[model samples]
Target: MAEARAELQKKETELTNAILKDVSDIVDAIGYEGGYAVILRSEVVLSAKKELDITGAVIRRLNESKGKPKEAPKVKPKEKPKDKK
Candidate 1:
């Protein structure tokens, strides 16, 4: 029973670590600080603001580049009409 409990606890810890790593990766990719305050508590409003600011800047840059030539949208093939015999 003790071994089973220990194994379960270890698995829980591993899962928690994996979740933290994923959240950290997302925060880093979007240029935000990763922490419980940002993800859970509402005390980290400044961090959230900064993250939004960064995202807005990225979007603005992308929009500004829209004037450049881009590939045409792909057209879907038209289906042939069935013959009514």
Candidate 2:
């Protein structure tokens, strides 16, 4: 049971890290074009001027970049457990 739990936790952590890395990459891609030094999510800030907003630009960039060919991360196939007769 402990081994199974540890394996599950490891898988969860890997999935979480992959998701975060993807988010970071997307933000970097948007920032590369927007020239923004700081980008905050909507829920994080209390109040900000419209001129300081980069959300619209990022959204537009995302839409424009959609359906483009992207490099995929290579994945190794998992080994299957042998069944006992």
Candidate 3:
């Protein structure tokens, strides 16, 4: 029974370590500035921030494209009609 108890404790510690690792990874990905606030306020804020950044990047690209003139698609010159068969 003592051996079984030791095994259980080991397993519990492993599980706790795994959870902490995941949380740390999440915190690191979210960054330090607003990450703590998001964790304290709402857990979904991290995902929201990620999505907002993606959307903002896409919008910025689209706006930049709109400001630039579209280039004509390049067409390679035909090979002189294949120089006769």
- The lDDT leader among the candidates is 2
Kindly report which residue stretches of model 3 are placed more than 4 angstroms away from their true locations once superposed: 32-85
Error of 1 at 48 (Å): 7.7
Q: All candidates' lDDT scores?
A: 0.59, 0.78, 0.58
- After best superposition, candidate 3 residue 21: deviation in angstroms? 0.2
Prediction-by-prediction clash tally: 0, 0, 0
Residue-level lDDT tens digits of model 2 in 28-71: 87777778787888799999998877767665655565556588
User: What is the overall TM-score of model 3 with all chains considered together?
Assistant: 0.38
Candidate achieving the largest TM-score: 2
Residue 25 C-alpha lDDT in model 2: 72
Residue 45, model 2: lDDT of: 96
Residues 1-85, model 1: lDDT tens digits: 9999999999999999976675555545445542233343345454455443444544454455445668899999999999999
Q: Supply the global lDDT for candidate 1.
A: 0.59
Error of 3 at 69 (Å): 51
Would you list the rank order by TM-score, best first? 2, 1, 3
TM-score to native of every candidate shown: 0.40, 0.53, 0.38
Pairs clashing within candidate 3: none
